[model samples]
Target: GGGGSTTVTTSTDTDLWKDIEAGVTKLLSPAGKVVVDKQSSNVLVTDLPKFLDRIASFLESVEGSVQRQVLIEARILEVTLTGEYQFGLDWGAITQAAALKGASTLSAGKILAQKFAPASGGFQIGVASTDFTALLSVLNSQGELKVISSPKLATLNNQTAVIRAGTDEVFFETRVLETPSLTGTQTSKTVNPRTVTIGVVLGITPQIGADGTVVLHIHPTVTEKRGEAKSAIGDTFPIIDVREADMIVRAREGQVVVIGGLMQEKRINNDSKVPLLGDLPGIGRLFSSTSQEVRKTELVVLLSPTVMVGKKVDEITSRELERLNKTKGRSPW
Candidate 1:
């Protein structure tokens, strides 16, 4: 459309032919080397005839879709030309202009039809001159354009085929209609340990001395607490039950008893809870006088957004989802 006058001028047309010959020569010339037998070979040396055939093939290929001199016209304005096909239709310059207009690859087919389709007519094979002029003006003003790929109905057919083949089973069935921008506070409470009945032996009977005094005995007692998960507080937490075992009584005196068990006690001069050995009659004297620090632990529930509800959880509904998709205008049209 731009060089229509120049196309008719004989002197001006000579330059266009020269440019085409130069392009063909460049394509036929081995621009790079080919590796053969572990040795680098120039394309001109390796296959000059093949390169010539390629350039000739390209010239013949564009006969039906594009004119050979369009490149020389666009080259005068420093505009780049690219070849693209859409739904088997060729718009040539108009397609390039559409790409400059921020059209996507997905939109290639539909955009060609919309822009090239004649009004009050059936269909046209090539882009109209008026459309090319309009697109060129847009390109000159915008300096550059984007190409986008528009979604097509053919994808639906592929999905249907996959479903029929049993390869497209539904993995995630839930979809949020309106995503909540803000998160609601999770309501959860701490749970107390279930009341577990336990029998604790304090001490064995101690032998009395001649003056009716009782001797104290003691030994080291180890206690282990087993923790379990409980959901009594609307959330799961760990609960520990301190199990007491029989205490080793080293000695006893005058009806004073020695027993096997660990007891709970508070540390002296400190608020930290500590376990103290249970009192035994003569065993206290044999080892040392002590107090029990036996304890049973209850679960304390904590609410957090990162809590896992199931074994595997999908958090795409969370506020963090804004970073994942990052695309806009996802609504089906």
Candidate 2:
């Protein structure tokens, strides 16, 4: 009882705790000792009661910080900007409002422009605020804004969360055997059919600060199979167009930051089939009807981050419930 040890078993990023061995040991008594067990991810600390108390407090703080979570509400928008604003979306419109002046209300980091779309170019971050009310109002008033997808999710600090919009394409790889005449002209090659995922995929890894500042590591990727390409030897393969970028930025709680500059032209296809007849492969077309839409639009992402601290979730739910009850003419909580 006079001398003892504490074992701290961690789940993720356990190696990081090992680096602070010196700092933790320094807080102990001269004779106190600490050792990190890599295999078990246990930190053994033998120290006096007073020093152990301090160490426990410190560890709790770090654990709380790391385990913190953030609820992210995202809206993907597409717009068509013309004339003088061809370079990109006019973030300058956001600065016009005195409340959102200086663009400090919005925040993001390193938004890149890709080659898939000619006008896909750079953008400014750090113009976020309570919500996207004003920003959307301004854009909507001037032009039409298409909301692509609205995804709401919660993730632990520094953990990755992915949101996808669109369809999954299934293509089979074919092994082609070609019989060439005496004069060798062309040959076939083995094809490995793979699962190809196409569409807009956004990946985010966010860290929430004590003061509610959210730092996000964002990766956006857009890919589509344009057509088929033929090799010199007559081998055929899918030609894919890919646009992707990685960036980091910071914003405040409930603030919606903007990620723009990705533009794309796509052919959206729709197919309708007759129950029994459409079940056949090659003959399916005879019983099916197909349609296509050609669209040219600029892609924009609106992301709002709300960190869960203390009893914030309860407060939010209470407010929401009260509002809902009022709408139905019921009593408040």
Candidate 3:
């Protein structure tokens, strides 16, 4: 045990090494020492044979080779209620129709119990990922459902996955400034072009435990460029609207969680007229008709997480990890 190297198998070398030295302090002799070589991913433990034997046994019990991966599937929707649903979406009826068979097992209580609208007491019911189609049918019957995005990605345990979809729209920012010139001070008007994305971004992090339970940290953001209007100073600018939410939930693999309660009202004007007659300043009223409509829409998100392992992990990576983690053995004399 004068000078030897032992590799960590379970957790990262840096994390395990930080606690190992203090944990075995009582067993250390004057010359005993344990150090980590992060570059080579090895832990060097130097001591007597008896002490080395104890360290070896401890490492054997604490370290193993089991790594997990996660697959995230997300669907974003916008629902516009009309006719019978003019007031708002009836989440209560939908939740009741699509019940989470073993709802008690999943921990989505407070997050799902949040109100979908100010006047409605409807709360979300737990739905298995596989059982969401039937629920979708029920939702369509309530309003006009629009699917905004469906993004999917895979990540290792304790890693974060980001899914983004949308486009960047151009705009102008104007500033009036006074500058010094060779003759005297001069007034200048400057126009700067700026861009903003009208799209959706979701940051999802999954932590899978050995028991097949997964804890998810979800953050979703969405922005829309509804229309354009003149600024106070007469500079034309685009009107933007944003809705976002952040939350954490726990559930077994393949469980579905729906996030809702975001609503927005949009105003649209419809004008119809005879081309030449409508343009006449004084008589346009005789040939032109104008109407306005207000639309109410709600944003809903559906997330489903599945714990991946072994062959499934390989399929996404397009390579086998078994060969990478294994190495030729070294004997301890």
Candidate 4:
């Protein structure tokens, strides 16, 4: 009767990810000093939440003339689990039936019968050793496994006692669990890419650890002019700055990053037997694995800033607001 249950508590990473992203953004700002490393650079924060709060406030306090816009989003990715177990049984009849279904079989009864002698009469022959071995062999082979139909069953294992009471019926139970969760953010330079778009997206890689410690690897680059500048000046602007700007914006992976975590649970059982423990003709090759199920919940944080290059700050802000209203069918406040 291995029917007891256990559950462990774990910390979530949602807040941790958000704080890190905010902190990094601040470090990249004009006032903040984030020394750029060759190829890529990163900062480790023991006090993550405090650092992120400072950055967020700094961004909010920027001079109104900067014409900046910000966006944020979060979402869940996936949740899953894997489990396995071993089972036991008695009686030659059950073994034979299980064998017909390709299940491993053992003869525990035979072994005990052999070991028992009237001269050594200290114990009663409750079950034979041979039958136990045969049953074990069947269980080990391939087909002795049985699937639990109930997902919320409380007990993983349920064995029937030879002492038959007034009731011949037996009951089995299973474990229950909810789905995992996901959440993160994505940020950009310009809100509208088609008209004045530039941005970056940060995603949290799932199936990591529980500590909420995420690795921040930042790589920044400036694109160079490919073609030699014309020795002779012409009417055309010396360079295609728009195209160059596009290349520059695209070359960088947007300065923003996202983060978050979810909850997960798993259950396994051993030494359990269920009803329908019989064999059916033609179903000899029939086999089934242990029952398990998974579900998921998602969350996300999206952060993006808007900046208009040539337009007046007020005009750009107004037009952008209008565009957002028409596109999203609501105000972005």
Candidate 5:
């Protein structure tokens, strides 16, 4: 039987074999490669360090873009005051006569003594940004005492004294009842006093430039019934006193601008005596003496604004959040 023989091929140049071996070694080296698994919808990569570095670079770019955006926060305040002043003088001769007639004279020096005598009243209002309604609300809440209290006057008086937007001015009117007096052939006749009105209008303009500087313009107008006179045709005309002014001021954030020295004069009359005699049938007028009082009241307004940006806003927000958490009985984050 013949034996099977295998043929073997061999190359004699060792350097050529070495070159082929080096080429195979280079192909098998640990270079990065991407493999995709279509069935599972997944991406597989071998170079993890380089992939992570690219992701880090992308996140840094996004963070830098976010930092470039900024926000502006601001707070504003408007203040106002309404004053009523009264002045009076004692009728010395009448009081002396009453004293001789066995009647006691009671002297109530001043009406509304505590409110108008010492200092003028003021109001403070604050809001975020240019919220005029909020500021007005504050003023209204604080100025309740200044509202007219006379029933007859209140019926014709304006409920609110503030000047809202769109209208340059507003007016308020009121009517009061006067004391009874003697008339022709009649024991007593009711006298209707002149109708009095107090009207106030306020105008404010704020100009804020790019440099954060603010220019404020304030205009105020006040009108009141001063007196009365008869016309040529037997008609009565009211004498009105009007006061108006314009003011300009420059201010910055968190600063106060005061518009002061606005004045108003009011007149009132009162009668006092020994209780029973003052209310007697016909001689009551003689027993009680009437004294006229005039008052001068001053009004002042204050305005302030605060601006916040970036870190300052953040700090305020954080503090607010903390306060909210405390109110809710929860730990702040």
Candidate 6:
């Protein structure tokens, strides 16, 4: 019975082995190979369209990104006329002449004449016989005066002369006199004249905008140098009349703008001394001559701007640098 069971098991195992060999031969056949090749080709064929579309989309995206980049440049501007201009005035000298007409005595007139002895070409002094008291009263009442006429000299002889005042029609005769002095006899006469100086200074800065507009900033200063004064510390300093202003203006390229009517005025009070008598309460007004001087002036400024572009700017800047180098006779780096 054991032998019979062993033979049966052996027979079953042999049949199983035979079945496995047949399955392996079927799988290795040419028709099976064809089936595998067909499946692989189908997969490749199916994925190829999508892969090609992805590649096309990537190329389109790269092209569109490239198109978005752009190059940009700015227009340049070349500016000129950055400098200072000045104008000036002196009032102390102008007032001295007006005071001379009101002087009461020869001593007072001589004092004023000496003070204004340095008259130059632009101004002249005229003297005629008139009521000094009347002149003083009129000057005091009006607080200002204009010379109505100028004097002309006429020779009566070698030793005498006549002064004719025009329009006012006044005349005076003078005879030359000789006096004996310790050293020798000499001829001298006192003469007085007055003059004035006036000035103004302007500084400018300009900037150009991208849209062809210009912005201009200006600094203007007015200085009137009256004369000199001694400080309480015994230091001498200039009596300066100064006024300043800062302004901003806007205009189109190549347009001119005018800034005008900047005006200034100054008043100074001066007294000729009698020392303690001049300082005395109330009565000081009589001993000391109190006078007021006023000065006024006006200023105007003009500016223009031009815009440069492209090749013009390059050429101009290069030429300007070359010219500057030539003028300086050295390299300005």
Candidate achieving the largest TM-score: 2
Q: In model 2, which range of ten residues has the least summed lDDT?
A: 1-10
TM-scores for candidates 1 onward, in order? 0.13, 0.63, 0.62, 0.15, 0.35, 0.25
- If candidate 4 were superposed on the true structure by all CA atoms, what would the RMSD be? 33.2
Off by over 4 Å in 1: 1-12, 30-47, 61-333
| Candidate 6 lDDT tens digits, 1-333 | 011000000011123223322322222213222111322322111223333343334333333322221111111111111112112222233235434664222111111211111222111112212232433333333223233222222111111111111111112223345789999998764433322223434443434444555444444444456577664534444565555555555555433343333334457687796989988998987888878965543232333344333212222334433543454533222
Model 3 per-residue lDDT tens digits across residues 220-258: 666677789998778877787766656667766657777
What lDDT score is found at residue 322 in candidate 1? 40
CA lDDT, every model vs. true structure: 0.24, 0.63, 0.61, 0.25, 0.37, 0.33
Ranking by lDDT: 2, 3, 5, 6, 4, 1
Among these predictions, the greatest lDDT belongs to: 2
* Minimal lDDT window, size 10, model 4: 156-165
Q: How far is candidate 1 from the true structure (C-alpha RMSD, Å)?
A: 42.8
Whole-structure CA lDDT of model 1: 0.24
Question: Per-residue CA lDDT of candidate 4, range 1-333, in tens?
Answer: 122121211223334334334434433323344332323424433324434444344334322323221121121112131222111122345446555655343222111112222221111111111222333344334322322110111110011001100111112222233444565443332222111111111221112111221112111111112222332322121221111100001101122221112122224333323344423455422432355443221111111111212222233334433443464533222
Model 1, range 114-146, lDDT digits (tens) per residue? Answer: 121111212221112222234446434432222
Clashes of 4: 65
Clashes of 5: 6
Per-residue CA lDDT of candidate 5, range 104-218, in tens? 4423221111112222332212112222233334334433323211111000010111232111222223333355457534243343444333454444444443455444454
